[model samples]
Structures are given as C-alpha cells and as structure tokens.
Target: MGGSFGANLRRIRDESGLSLAQLAAKINYSKSYLSKIENDLKPPTADIAKRCDSLFGTAGFLSAMVTAGERPDGDQDEDVADDEVWVMVAGDDGERRFHRLPRREVLTGVGAAAGFALTGGARAVVDEPTLAGLRTMFGQYRLLGTTSSPATVLAPVIAHVDTLRALAAAGHPESVRRQLLLLASRAAEYAGWMSQEAGDERAALWWTHRSVAFAEAGGDEHFASYALIRRAEIAMYRQDPLTTIELATLAQADRAAGARILGLAARCEAQGHALVGDRAAYRRALDRAAALLAEADPAVPVLGSSSVSDEVALADGWSLYDLGRPAEAAAALDRQFPGITASARRARARFGARRVLAHAGNGEIDHACELAPAVLADAAQVDSATVRVDLRELARVLARWPGHPAARELRFALGTALRVRPGSGG
Candidate 1:
C-alpha cells in the first residue's frame, strides 16, 4: 500500500548520488524526512508532492494523494481550517490543500519513538519560515491521521518535512537556514519514526544522527538535548542500559532548557533506573517526571516522548509497568489519550497492543488479550522487530495460564513475533 514511493524516492534521489545530508542541503528538507518519504510510513501534501515531482522529476508522485478516496468526508464541516502553517520559520495560515502522499500499511509505536526524539514541548528559538509553515503542518497532520487510509495517512507529513528540507537547501539566508536547522530537528525525528515504522532501522538511525547534527548546527541546545534522549531510548531497547543511563544524565544536565526538557531527562534517567533494578532511584526519578509533567502546559506540543503532558504520563506509566507496578502502572497509563483529533484509530492493532498491556497490568487478561490485534495488523508496522515491549511480556503472563484458548493464542502469536526480531533468540 505504500506504493514503492519511498523506494522510488530514494532510488531517484540516490541515483543522483546524493547523500541524505547532501540532498537535504540542496532542497531544504531534513535529510531524515526525505529519507522517510522515500521509505513510506509518511505521505506528502500537494505542496510537498509538487516539490518532489519538481525535484526528482517524478510525475504523479503527488497526484495519487489528491485523487485517492481516503480523504475524510466529515471534517469538511470543521471550518477552523484556519490554523497557521509554519514554513521555514515563517508562520502563516494552513491552506485548504489536497495532496497524494503515499502511506504506510499500518501505524504503531514508531510514532511514539519519533515523538520521543522530537522537541519535548520546551520551546526553542526556531527558524522563521519553518515556524510559520509548521503550525499548519502539525494541525493538518493530526487530522490527516484520522482521515486517511494506511496507504496515505502518514506520508504527507513526512513529505512536507522532506520538502522543507529541500527548501532549506535552496540556499536561503543564514536566518532561513538556521530556522530550518531547528525545524530539521523535528523533521529528522519524524523521518526516523516513519522510516522505523516502515521497518527500516538503518534509515532510522541515520535520520536520528542527522537530527542530532541538525540540532547542533542550529546552535539548538534544547533540540540537541532532546535528540540525545531518543538515543537513550534506543539503547534501552537494545538492553545497553549503561549507555541509556549516561545519555539520560547528559540531557539532565541541560536543565536550563525548560521543564519539558528536564522532564524528559528525568524520564530517561528513570528508565535507566528501572533497568538497573534500582527501585528506590527509579521511583525518585519517576516522581520527578510526574511533577515536571504535571506542572507543564499540556497544549504547547512538546515533540516525542515529552510532547503531550500525558506523554510523560504514558511513558511513566509504562516504565512503572515494566518495573512491575501493575496497579500503579495501570493508573498512570490511564491518564493519556487526551484525544487525538478524531480518536477512533486506537482501536487498531498497535494501540490495541498497548491497551492490552495496561489492561493486563490491571489484572484484566481478557481485556489484555483483546489489545493484541486491533493495532498490530502488521508485525512490521512498529519496525520489523517486536517494538511493542509489552507483547514480549505477554508470552510470560499468558504462560502462567497455559490452558486457556485466548492465552494459548497469545502465546503462539508472541513466539512467532519474537523470532522476527533480529537477535531475539528466546
């Protein structure tokens, strides 16, 4: 369903023999974003669509999105299409535009990871054009998630980012380039998410590093601090918790950034604490994450793991769940989902898995089993490996009840999923 868009985008761009960073320099999109659109978890809007076709000379690259049947029919009535669009650091209004960006076959925790990599709501001095265009871009993409099909939903946002990178490379003044460097942090993070979501880890890490570089280039201490946290999460999952703890502490030292940044630093440190089984310290860090999160403005849009106030809430809840606080974890996880623009999609496979995890933590096995499928339609959705950490635990929880059909079913599914992850021999 992704329509060879990402592959085609990459082939075309790379055939030109340009490195992602080089291509990004030419146009203005972050190398990471262009990398994602080429991979497909995200689609492009007409603005971006046209830009790609123009740059790569691929006609109909964007045409399909505009002509697709996935557009939501209901929001045609929500007249506030008036939100501003942040373009290369300039803030302006979002347009009544249409695009034909390619799509992902599914959505999953990949976005969660990307969300983790982005700015954690603590504001930064951004590039102007990007600021103007981003306002509309963010608002539109949120709605797009609810409106489009798996084939077209995410790509547009990624595509927009790709286009911005393209624009950034067009050689605008240092002012514009500087702003894009800031936006590039967000774009690259999204690119990493989309690429990882599409199951391309090499691309994911590439975007991730590039994002950190962008943050650094822009003199963006805040963004750089945030990117480092994402690296910590990557290390945590790989089970290299020492590195996770180190990176998390590095971010913690940048407290001058703001509450959201400090909150993320605390969250990352807490994750490391849980890994080391330092119960007391983990609890202390968890308490700090909770406090910083509680006092912050929920709507300012902190990107990634710290984006929404409820984001830290969700992460804290999951961390606690991982640390074995079933009751408390269930309670914390419940504080999230402050309502994505339309809200019905969570009933899908990926979100369902997380839902199942929380339900299980609350001793609701029946409910827990239910979350396994709705959101995980594609094993590859949350990155080819088993990105849903809770599922890895599902096998254990269900094994305790070996005879139930539901438990048996969960066990079989989890076992198969385990083998797909690169080194998960167990």
Candidate 2:
C-alpha cells in the first residue's frame, strides 16, 4: 500500500512536470524527505495526502487511494462521498463564521490546464505590475457597475476572484499576499452587490460572507467592517429592517474601521430606524453619519473614485421614503438624479423608480405617472430586480386610483417592463 501510494505521488508529480526538488519546494518539504516518501521508504501523512488532493484537483481521489489501501477494501470509499468543504474564518465578534463550498468548485485542478495553474503553497510570485492590473480592472468594473446592470460584470468579477484566490493560496511575499487577498475581498464584495441587484439573494449573501472572510484574512479590519455594512444594505433591500440594524450595528462597533465605513454603517442603521418608524433614532443616526462624513477623507480607500456624498444622499432618499416623508424623499432624489451618469443605468433605475414611488406615496399620482416612462425604460433596459421591486410597490399604490388614466397607463407600463403577470408573482 505504501509503495502504491509512493508510485501514485511520483506519477502525479511527473504529470505536473515539476522536478522533485521543485515539487518539494512548492509543498514546503525537503527534497530528500519527499524522495524517501516517493520511494516508499517513508509513508505520507494525512496532511500530505490532503495537500496532494488540493494541488491535483482530484477531489480526494489520491488521498482516498493512499489511505484506503491501508484499510480493508470495503472501507475504501467511505470518505469519498464527502463533497463539501467548510472554511472557518474569524467573525467580527471573535466567533468563527463557516463558509461552505463544494469541493469541486474551489478545486480547479479537475482539468489539465487548471491543474498546471496550481503552484502548491510555496513562494509563487505575482509581480507588482500584475497586482496593479488587478486593481485597475477592479476599478473599471466597479465604475461600470455603478451605472450599468451588475449582471453584465458578475461573471468577470467572479473569475477575477478565482485568480486572486489562487494567488493567495499559492503564497507570495507577505505584503503582496495581503494585497492580493484584499483585492479578492473587494472583488467579492462587488460580486455580492451585483448578485443582490440581479435579485439573487442567496448568491448575494454567499458572496458577501466570502467578502467578509477574505477581508478579515487580509488583515483589513476596516474593509471587513465595510463588508458587514454592505451585508446590511442587502438586508435593507430585502426589507429585513431588524437584520439590517443588527449588521449595521455590528459594523459600527468595529472601532478600527475608518470614518467612511463608520458613516456608511450609521447610514444603514438610520435606514433601519426609518423602516421601523423610529424618527428620533433615525435623526440621531443621520446626524452622526453627517459628522462622520465631515471627518472622513475625501477619497474612498479601496476604490478612490466612488462618491461618498452621492451614496449618502441615495441612502437618505431611501430612508426618507421608508419613514413616510415621501415629499422630502422625492425632493432629495431629484437633486441627485441629474448627477448620476448615463452609464449608471442601475443607479438611475433605482433612484428614478423610488422617486416615482415617493410621488405616488404623496398623493401625486399624476406626477408619479409622468415620471414612469423613463423609469420603465431603464427597468426594461437593465432587467434589474431591485428596480422591479420599487416598480412593484409603485404599482400597488397606483392601483388604488383605478379611475385615473395615468395610473392605468403606469400599471400597464410596469407590467410590460417587469413581465409580471396580472395574478402572478411580484
């Protein structure tokens, strides 16, 4: 059994085209020690077997083969069915958060080309130029997402995340490795945001959880806190106000987080307060957010181009509407409407649809209907789930005035825009 295992290890190493010394270096083993194991003079430990499995993308095939040979044949496939792998990362409260991934998904070594990309855990090098490229790509993707449907960038963002994950796992100089992980964190957060916008709540949460883990592992407490705030934003979108408040509060408690993150947390908390009609608490949160923003640096740390002021205003509008101050919400939204660039179709759809709802909420059905065309157009163009949500709410309000031609027209437009059947789902 030991000889067979050694033969299998040697075969895999040969197939990978790595010399014994190089392979040993990659796996952090001495060459002579690995040679002894390969020649069956020394048996491979469970740790070595698992590392081999990960490196080869064999889904534990080698591990099972080696370990099973030592046991009765009947017990050979006992552990074969364990397809899920759980990764535990430290949570903000010092507890562990478990992220479960299918063994197949994380191990790209299933294919020949992908297997070659696995550099083990040794000193894999990703140059500064490559890191800079990833950052620039992230910046472009994020900027594009602000104005366009996130669906357009989701796949690419996920692919970029895979690259970063591979690089981080393969190892690098300490500083470069940390930056790579932070890059992964930012990409994952963007992916989560896109998933949420596209209406895949489960995917959104999954990516958000991954983002938090990556951020923490990368030693960026501030980014980790910001990820929680983003999770709170998702909660807000789901109309889960209590969860939103909880997550936002957790983020706020991260004293290591910078002012921008703190301000974002306060804004999210304020949104939750508004949702529950706690006007005083909402007011207090808004005031605190204002102060925090005043002290915040002009540029966002990760993505320097995002306008914090615009984000705050958008949050304010949403919260105001939730608080039943539709007039003020509509007014606030109007001020930022023109400033949102042409490419930010998703942003335009959300704010525009919200403004329509605000007008409808304030007994201005005619004006709300007047703004319906542009909102509907953007909704149809982007196919955004977030916009569809706001549009659905607006439809419910407009439904109250059946006699109004504008209301009927608006409802008809929304139905066409969102593909919502007359008696079916929202």
Q: Which candidate is the best by TM-score?
A: 2
TM-score of 2: 0.70
Whole-model Cα lDDT per candidate?
0.55, 0.71
Residue 207's lDDT in candidate 1:
61
**Regions of model 2 farther than 4 Å from truth:** 1-125, 299-309, 420-426
Candidate 1, residues 1-426, lDDT tens digits: the string is 354656766776777777878866554455776767766867743323434454554443443443355433431111111121211111144212222222221111123223323636222333555468675675566444332332243355555555455455555678777676667667767655554444344445556666777777777767777767776766666545466779888987877767777777788888776554455667688789778766667676666632232555566665654444455655655455433222434223333455566565455777667756644443333323324555675566566556678878877877776655422233
Q: What lDDT is obtained when candidate 1 is compared to the true structure?
A: 0.55
| Worst lDDT 10-window in candidate 1 | 82-91
Alpha-carbon error at 83 in model 2, in Å? 7.4
lDDT of 2 by residue, 144-215 (tens): 776555546665677677678767876577888799888888888877777777666666767777777788
